[model samples]
Target: MEISQYSAEQIATLQAKLEKKLGPEYISTRPGPGGGPKLTYAEGWKIINLANEVFGFNGWSSSITNLTIDFIDVHGENPPRYNVGVHCITRITLRDGAYHEDIGYGTAENVKQKAAAIDKCKKEAVTDALKRTLRSFGNLLGNCLYDKTYTEQVKNIKLPPVRSSTLLLDVL
Candidate 1:
């Protein structure tokens, strides 16, 4: 996927926002495991935590029980081709036993694709947990993202606390 060239103005805007939200510890484009420009996995998790808080992705017990990041060798050279980019594999398990293992890339296109799957997992976990946790025990199955049928059930939900997994499956 092609990285978009950011305008100077856009960079400035993003810088301002990052500075405000990230305080002094934020570092952009640090060296990743695959030698790409990105934060260390641990650092990236901190950013993820912040986003979850900001977006109120605060429901259900969801954890990345397993995560693996590696470089896919495209050519069979002696040392092998590496860092063409990285693959981030996440095995997410929800409290209600609804889970999925999703594959994503740091690239723009794949990131967008993975994000939708991630959001779906979030919605499924939350809705399922609510049913299990609530007194009335209602069915909340439907597509997320403004699907009208599940609106009432979703509206009555109170987002639960979030806990992240520490099971790192990093590979070289």
Candidate 2:
């Protein structure tokens, strides 16, 4: 459905839902290297699922607006390991044509093949950019995580559980 089909009430409802704080349960923490502050994040798959839940599959879309290999390094000649760095800018657009864009960087180190490193770097860059772009939509899409003052103690209203499709599950 187009943005025109979304009645004001529907738009208001979606806005309310998007404004809600993200649930703490959706976050995951990993210990940083060298005992630094733990790194916290919502996984890529979870981010995608949240987008589907809040926006309806047809309500929003994303595109990699720009992508390029920032650098590539190949180590020792025989069966060289390749290290590649990629950069991407992703744009997320609602059916209304409102959009947000964000940049992301991805690096692949110690990859056995040049092609493999390039592939991994590109995918990672796109996913990173997509996640960064989507965060602008609201906390449920993970904007809260970026806020230094955000507290996990604060609760988010419970949203009904959603059943994800088998295809999406398998593909992810």
Which tens-of-lDDT digit does each residue in 92-120 have in candidate 1? Answer: 33333334544444422222244444444
- C-alpha lDDT (0 to 100) for residue 32 of candidate 2: 76
RMSD vs true structure, all candidates: 20.5, 5.5
**Which candidate gets the maximum lDDT versus the true structure?**
2
Per-model TM-score versus the true fold: 0.22, 0.81
Clashing pairs in model 1?
Answer: 59-160
Q: Give the TM-score of candidate 1.
A: 0.22
As for model 1, its CA RMSD to the true structure in angstroms is 20.5
**Ten-residue region with minimum lDDT total, candidate 1:** 134-143
In candidate 1, which residue ranges exceed 4 Å CA deviation?
1-20, 28-42, 57-172
Instruction: Record all residue pairs in model 2 with backbone atoms less than 3 Å apart, i.e. clashing.
Output: none
Tell me the lDDT of model 1 at 26. 25
